[model samples]
Target: MNLLSKFATVGGATLVSRIFGFVREMLMASALGIGPVADAFNLAFRFPNLFRRFFAEGAMNSAFVPLFSKALEEKGEAAARDFATQVFSFLTVVLFALTVPAIIFMPFLVRTVIAPGLNVCIDEAALQQALSCEDRFGITVAFSRIMFPYLASMSLVAMVGGILNAYRRFFAAAAAPALLNVVLIGVLVWALWDGQDTRALGFAMSWGVLVAGVAQFVMVTVAMRMAGFSVALRRPRWTPDLKRLLVLAGPAALIGGITQINLFVGQAIASFKPGAVSILTYADRPYQLPLGMVGVAIGVVLLPELSRALKGGRLDEAQHTQNRSLEFALFLTLPAAVALFIIPEPIIRIIYERGAFTPSTTAAVAAVLGIYALGLPAFVMIRVFTPGYFAREDTRRPMMVTMASAGANTVLSVALFYVMAEQGIALATSLAGWLNALLLFHGLYSRNLWIVDRSLVKRCCLLLLCAALMGGVLLLLMPLLSHWIQPGAGIGVQVLAIGILVAAAVASYFALCFVTGAADRQMISRMLAARRKRGARNA
Candidate 1:
């Protein structure tokens, strides 16, 4: 399959997952709102997900895919399988050791690392007599313990996913995340049907997270087997290959650690104000749609693709891959960021306003979402650029760059928390994302590892102009459609309004792209022709 085809495979699946995620978040808002239980559940899940990203997605993808791809490219499937098995055995043992202690020490983690701001609730009079501090803290601990096992499951999933992507089987692993949303949606549906309270729903959802993790692991494992590869855990041994994998992965792990620390700092600060954590999370969902679709597609597809190209000493192919991935990331993300920045409230209102999600809550979430939108391109570009480093097995540079950005994020978040509440935290994160992206870009360019192709640079400038025009269109349209998207509007009306706005915005943007020559017709034709050929081959 071609590059765009691979992107479509992963991106199409991620789009499904993100859609289900939206439905799941909407149900969650209805059942829990931004209440104590919502806060606890968001915090609980964030804790495990932090490690999931740190150990699994960020570290494993960076280290594992390249090594595995190199083995498959140079050595053979047998060598690749051996290396994968060793990593699997060692990773399993490590995750087991990690999960047990995490669950056992859940309380301490909650009090210190997870959500330190929750300590304010212990003082009762410190913030307000809002809810039971003891109850919130206790359930948060319980929820964390219940869901911590998910890290193990997802770690295995990531390992298997790396194996699959190394073989260019992208759909299964990308689709696995949708199962989480589906499982949680089922849990919420049952809770809503059974008339469960917020506390009961929180416990149910936490368990649902663990179950979804297992499901995802199973899905990816099956995909690997079907692809004629299987990983059996051997007794743990420090094979040279395993040592090399860890050596490469270590810096990536630290990178993930720093990034998660930045996130935890934001969450901790948000925890000081009631509902701030959930508000930020809710605001995060809309922009995540585009990020997940474009950014994830690029990250997952580009790494393995680049590894193969660079391993074969195909410098031109690798450079072309980098340039196209960068162009594609910006093309899709810029308009999205613009739209989110221009009209976040309408989007947030349409999605979350139905349930216990109040207009006031919508306002708060919308503000944060707008700030996040400003950084959307940066977030996606990070994905595009990092593969340039990782595909060459250069993990340390990105780690150092990540450290600088995370440090900036920390200082800025602390500085801004006193001024703007949750929105301040969001702004810090967005700014940090840009810093990370720019530094990564400069690192690549300065080393001549990623030379700026003329097409890429020109298309980027044109895309920016197109996005700006689209933003202007949305600005003109939002006020005109305010009644249809207002708080008390019918859900159908709101949906239709959003649909119309999106259609108009997208139509105008594409039209402008074609008119201004930002979008290459011949390149699009090749993508389409490749799609046809692949379909014919399948038939």
Candidate 2:
């Protein structure tokens, strides 16, 4: 499939999943807004999710796909299947072993990494302004213990999903996360029906994560079978394949872990402020939508394509593919960044400002979301650029870049906390994202790994022009529509106004793109054609 078509296929399904996810979040927010209950829930949920991002999103994918793709190219399907078997045997044993220690020592780890967040970090004066919520370490501990082993299930899913994706079976892997939202929504609804406190509901969510993992694994396993891959477990093997996977995964882990560890820094710092972790979680909702749909979809799909191209000594094709992917991302993601930065209040008000999510909560979350939007493009660009290295089987270099970015993230997060209040934690993350992108892009350019080809530069200029026009319209219309778009107003109004703003931005962007000829109708038409072909295949 062409770039835009691939993105749309994944992005459209992803968008559906995200919309459902937003529903789940809305229910969770209303049922357990940023109180002690919400704090505990977010903490418990994040335990697995943090690791999920580390393994599924980066470490495993970075290491596995290139090698798997190479094996397929060099030795055909049978050889690739053997390689996958060796890798899976080793992975299952290691992760299963990890579960035992994880279950046993999880409490201490929770106390160490998360205990610091169980209470307010603010001083006496700030306490008066902070959200009213109890300090319930008892509830936190109970929920955390019930939840932490979900990691074992998640680890299994990540390994299996990686294999499926490597086999050019992305639908199952991409659709896996939707199961988590499904499980959580079901559990939360059941809890409400049973009239349970959110603390119990939080435990339900954790177990739900386990269930979701199993369900996800089953789905991918079935998909693999349809594609003629197998699930027969074999004796744990120590082989060359295992060694190679580990070597690649280790560096990818360090590179990816930088991002995760940065979150720990934010959680550590934000923990001092009551409800800050929850606020960060709230802000991330909108940020994650675009990030998931385009940024992650491209990263997930791009590496293998790039790896195949580069391994075959098709540098020109690899470069061409990279430019097209960058163009595809720029066309969609820049406008999303602007929309998030400009319209966070409407989104926050619509989706979250119910029950315990008060006016003050809305304002706080909107500020953080707005700040996060500042780095949205950077976040997408990282996905767009980093694949160039991963496709070439270069993992160690991204680690160096991530380390520098993480260091910057930590320092800025600390400095900004006092200067801009707790929400500055999100701002710091946003800045780190941009800084990381700049460093990666520059590093890639310096090594001549990524040439700023003419088309990419032209597309970049077009994106800037489009962004300027979109921003102008938002600035003009936002004030005129403020009364109708009040953040504390009804959900319908907030939804309506935000919808209008988004439509305006999209329409303005398209009109400008057409006028500037950043890309022509034929290019878009190709994507539409590809989308139809994909749809027919799925049908």
Candidate 3:
């Protein structure tokens, strides 16, 4: 498949997953809102997610995909499958060892690492009377223990996903996340129907997480087997291949560890405030949509593609792929960033300001969303640039850079939380993202691995111009549509108004891009036409 075709397959699946994820989060908002239950759930959910990023998405996939793709290219299916099986065995052993201890020490971890602020009991009587900080802490510990096994399942899912992506099977791998959302949404609906209490609902949600992880793992494993790469579990052994994998995974894991630590720091600091964690999480959901659809899709596809190109001595193709990926990422992400920055309030209100979620909550979440939007482009660009290093099997530099970024994030998040509250934490994360992106970009450019072509540069400029125009249009239109998006409005009216606003922004952005020659109408038309023909032939 061509780059855009592969991107479309992966991106389209991710788009579906992200949409379902929004539904899941919206339900979560209504079910839990920004109280102790909501805060506790967010904290609990974050524990497993933090580890999943560290092990599965970050370290494992980064090391596995390129190596696995090279094995497929150089050796054959048999050799590749053997490598995958070995890695799987080793990973299974490691994750099992990790998960047990993590579950056992959940309370200690929650008290110390995850949310030390939750342990504080100053003004205990008032806290007990109002939010019940101690109760929230205990619930967070319980929920975290229930959800911790997801790390193992998702890590295996990521490994299987890497194998599938290497085989150019992106859809099932990308679509696996949607299953998690679907399962969670189902559980949410069932719990609501049963009229469960907050603690019971939290337990149900935690169990849903575990079930979804297993479901996702099963889906990807079946897909991988159908693709003729079944990874039968075997006793772990220290083979040379396993050693090489570990060697590469070590630094990559450090990078992932650093990145997750940055996140933990932000969340930890936010936890000190009464509802800051939930507020930041709610605000994070919309930006995650574009990040997942654009950044993650590009990264997943780009890594294996770059590895294959470099393996075949296709330097020019690799460079072109990198450039095009950057251009495409910016093309989609810039407009999203602009829209989020311009219309966070209306967007948050339409999606979340109902049930227990209030107007004040929407305003707070919107403010965090706006700050996060500032970092959206930077975050996407990090995904684009990091593959340049990973494809070259250079994880150490990224790890070092990540350390600096994480340190900065820690310092800034702590410093700013007292000043800007939750928004400060969000702002710190954005600034850290920019710093990380800049460092990655410089690393690539300095090594002459990723030199931007003039055309790519011009297109990026045009994308920025279009995004600015879209932002201006939104600014002008938002006031006129404010009444329709107010908290008091009916759900249908709010949805319709938000939909109209989004459509208008997207239309104007594309129109501006076309008028400015940033995007060529003829090129897009030809590409779509070609894709259709290819599809027909396959059919």
Candidate 4:
């Protein structure tokens, strides 16, 4: 498949998954708003998700995709499959070992790292009246243990997903995450409809996570089998390939862990403030939609493509891929950042300020969302640039850069939390994101790995201009349409108003892109045409 086609496949599937995720978050907000239950659930969810980055999405994919793609290209399918099996066996053994200890030490983790604020609040009578903080802490620990096994299952899914993506079978791998959201939504709906209390709902959601993990793993494993690459568990062997993978994977895992630690710091700090954890999570959801669709889609496609190109000694192709990936990433992400910054209040109010979620909560979450918006482009660019290092099998430098970013995040988050509260934590994350992106870009440039050309620069500048214009339009229109997006407005009206505003923003941005000649309409048309012809041939 062509680059755009592969990106569309992954991006389109991811868009679906993110939409379901939005629904899942919306339901959770309505059912459990920013209360003790919501805080507990988010804290528990964060545990596995933090490790998911380290084990599944970030570290594992970074190390596995390039090497597996190389094996497939160089030796043959049998050799690649054998290597995959060996890795799979080793990964399963390690994850199984890790999960047991993590589950056993869940309380210690919650006390020291995940939610220290809970212990402090357990003595506050007022907080106890709302929901017993001691009980909530216990629930958080139990929920975390229940959800910890998901890390193992999802890590295996990531391995199979890497195999599929390396072979250009992107659809099933990309779509697997949607199943988790779907499962969560069902569990939440049932819990809400049954009039279950908050604690029961939280417990149900934790179990839902385990069920969904199993389902996702099954779905991707089926896809791998369909692609004629069934990687089954075998006796653990210390092969040279496996050892090299571990070497690369160790640093990548640390890099991913560092990024998650930044989040951990934010959450741990936010935990001290009532409802701040859920507020930050709610704010984080909207920006994640664009980030997942653009940044993740581009990164997933770019890594293996770059590896194959560079391995084949195709420098120009690799360069073009890098440039286009960055251009495409910014093309989608810049406007998203602008919209989030410009209309955060209306967006948060319309989507989340209902049921138990209040106007005060909306305002707080909006502030956090706006701060996070400032870093959206930086976050996307980091994803686009990091593949340059990973595809070249260089993980140590990125890990070092992440270390610096984590240090900055820690200092800033601690310093800012006392001053600006939760918004400060969000702002600190944004600043750290920019620092991380700049450092990654500098590393690539210093190594002569990334070459920025004129066309890429011009397009990026035009994209910024278009986004600025879109932001202006949004700022101007928001006041006029404020009543329809207010917390008291009817939900249907709010949805319609937000939809119209978003549609206008998207239309105007694309129109400006066309007018400025920054976007190549003919080139896009040709790509679509080529995709169609290829589809016909396959048929």
Q: Give the TM-score of candidate 3.
A: 0.96
Once fitted onto the true fold, the runs of candidate 3 whose alpha carbons sit more than 4 angstroms away are 122-131, 254-260, 520-523, 534-539
How much is 102 displaced in model 3, in angstroms?
Answer: 1.3
Candidates 2 and 4: which is better by lDDT? 4
Give one digit per residue, the lDDT tens place, for model 2 in 57-161: 677778888888888889998888888888777777877787677767766766677646555434534442233434455566667667666666676677677
Give all candidates' CA lDDT scores.
0.88, 0.77, 0.85, 0.88
Question: How displaced is residue 231 in candidate 3, in Å?
Answer: 1.4
Residue pairs with colliding backbones in model 1 are none
Residues 270-380, model 3: lDDT tens digits: 888777888988988898899889887898899888988888999999999999888889889999998888888888987888777888889999999999999999888
The collision pairs in model 4 are: none
The C-alpha local distance difference test score for the whole of candidate 1 amounts to: 0.88
Return whichever of 2 and 3 wins on lDDT: 3
- The superposed Cα distance between candidate 3 and the true structure at residue 55, in angstroms, equals 2.6
